[model samples]
Target chain A: MKHACKRVSQLTSDSFERELSLTEKMQLKLHFAMCSLCRNYHQRLATMAGIFEQMREHDLNQDIQLPIEDKQRIQSVLEKEK
Target chain B: MVDKQMNPKLWLKEHGDYLFRYALSRLHDTELASDMVQETLLAAWRGHERFKGDSTLRTWLVGIMKHKIIDHIRKEIRHRDISDRLEHDPTSTYFSENGSWQDSPSAWRDNPEALWDNQEFRQVLQECLSHLPEKQRNVFEMRELTGDDSETICNAYDITPTHLHVLMHRARLALQTCLHKHWFGGHTKS
Candidate 1:
């Protein structure tokens, strides 16, 4: 009884990374049926994953450029190699 | 014969920005990211003679950079703050001894999806990410940003799937709490 909520929340997180077993699926649905807090927890996890996805896309365009000093330093290293 | 694409100058000129961003995403330090790109170019130069042209030059350079990034991650793990490593269990006190919620997650008044466009929300998210424990932050960022399959990351980090899941789960929980507090106005006691 004590382990029920914690385990359900963990399984909810697990659902993102891998396929949950039928048992897990049924267990989560059943728990979610009875517990709104657990439902909120699961929903929040999904929402958070969505936020990260958005951030990743944003990072693709927003990345900072290589510093001029670093570029000069890399060129010197290449010349030394030559 | 050196592939024209393999010329170190070409790499520096063309792929430098891409490589720097890639390393920066993983390392989260401007200096370290730049160092990795440079190191990757040097390694590629030394080893280009052995190149079989099995992959695109960019792919090959990324391959070298991946190794360098992983190597640095290993060192970073060793030097990670002792306190940060000691307790990343974001769930501590989240539940009672009975594993029941001491205080369960509360309703978020606004839809998080709708708030994605809010610049403040984005800033808050970044702040939450920085608050994560060093290793957990690295692993979470690697997993989220790269979109690489779990197996590849587990093998690279020498962590089992269960360990990976635990690290990711805890990190997400921490982020969720932080965002709820700062962005959503639901206070989470530190």
Candidate 2:
């Protein structure tokens, strides 16, 4: 049980990077069925991953326009370099 | 019809802000982001004769900026050894000796889709991300946001895959703890 919990935590993180093997997948499913605590942790982790993805998309379209002074500065610097 | 061959000055005026925002998103520093954009513009100016018009000028400029941004990140990572710093963080408290969560995570009050629409939530999230340590933030951003593969990320930072996983795990744990506090009205027992 001790090692099971640790493996569950690791498996939760590993899911993000790569596919889980059959044995690992079976272990996690079996653990989640009985351990509500681990189940909750897994759910929250997945939700956080989802939010991070959405955040990336949202920020890319955000209105964080560059300041005018910086824009002019870059322009002038480029002009000088040219 | 818009001129097919626009001047470098005109290109800056037309696409500079977009390019600046793109660089800023990845670099997370205004001065560095500005330098990347400047460098991109200079590169574009010097290589103007190679502009085949196959892609828009903005696309070409952004392509150049991406390389510059990656180069800058590689250089920055090479200057510091973050392994000890990352390992010594207090995130170990999140788990117990038995490997179970010390304080199990509670379900978020709002679903991800709803939270995405909530401007205040997004602002809090951005603040939380900024609060992460530099190396953790870089690793998290590169993997999650930029969608860089683990191998590329490891090579760029000169860390092994195992180390990368540890950094990423800690990063996610920290973000989860932070968002729980800010968005979910502090942690609730699961």
Which numbered prediction scores highest in DockQ against the true structure? 1
Instruction: Give the CA lDDT, 0 to 100, for residue B132 in model 1.
Output: 90
For each of the candidates, the C-alpha root-mean-square deviation to the true structure, in angstroms, is 3.6, 3.7
iRMS values in order, in angstroms? Answer: 2.0, 2.4
lDDT of 1 by residue, A1-82 (tens): 6688877777888898899999999999999999999998888887777766776666654557899899999999998997
Give the Cα lDDT of each candidate. 0.79, 0.77
Query: What are the per-residue Cα lDDT tens digits for candidate 2 across B88-156?
Result: 756668877866678776656467888777778778888888888888888888888767678767766
For TM-score, the strongest prediction is 1
**Residues B129-189 of candidate 1: C-alpha lDDT, one tens digit per residue:** 8999776887788888667678767765667898888888788778878887787664342
Worst 10 residues of 2 chain A by lDDT: A57-66
Q: Which one wins on lDDT? A: 1
Candidate 2 per-residue C-alpha lDDT over A1-82 given as tens digits, one digit per residue, 9 for 90 to 100: 8756656776778878778899888988999999887787788788878877887777654677777887888878877866
TM-score of candidate 2 relative to the true fold: 0.80
Query: In candidate 2, how many Å is residue A2 off?
Result: 1.9
Off by over 4 Å in 2: A77-82, B1-3, B49-56, B80-91, B145-152, B185-190
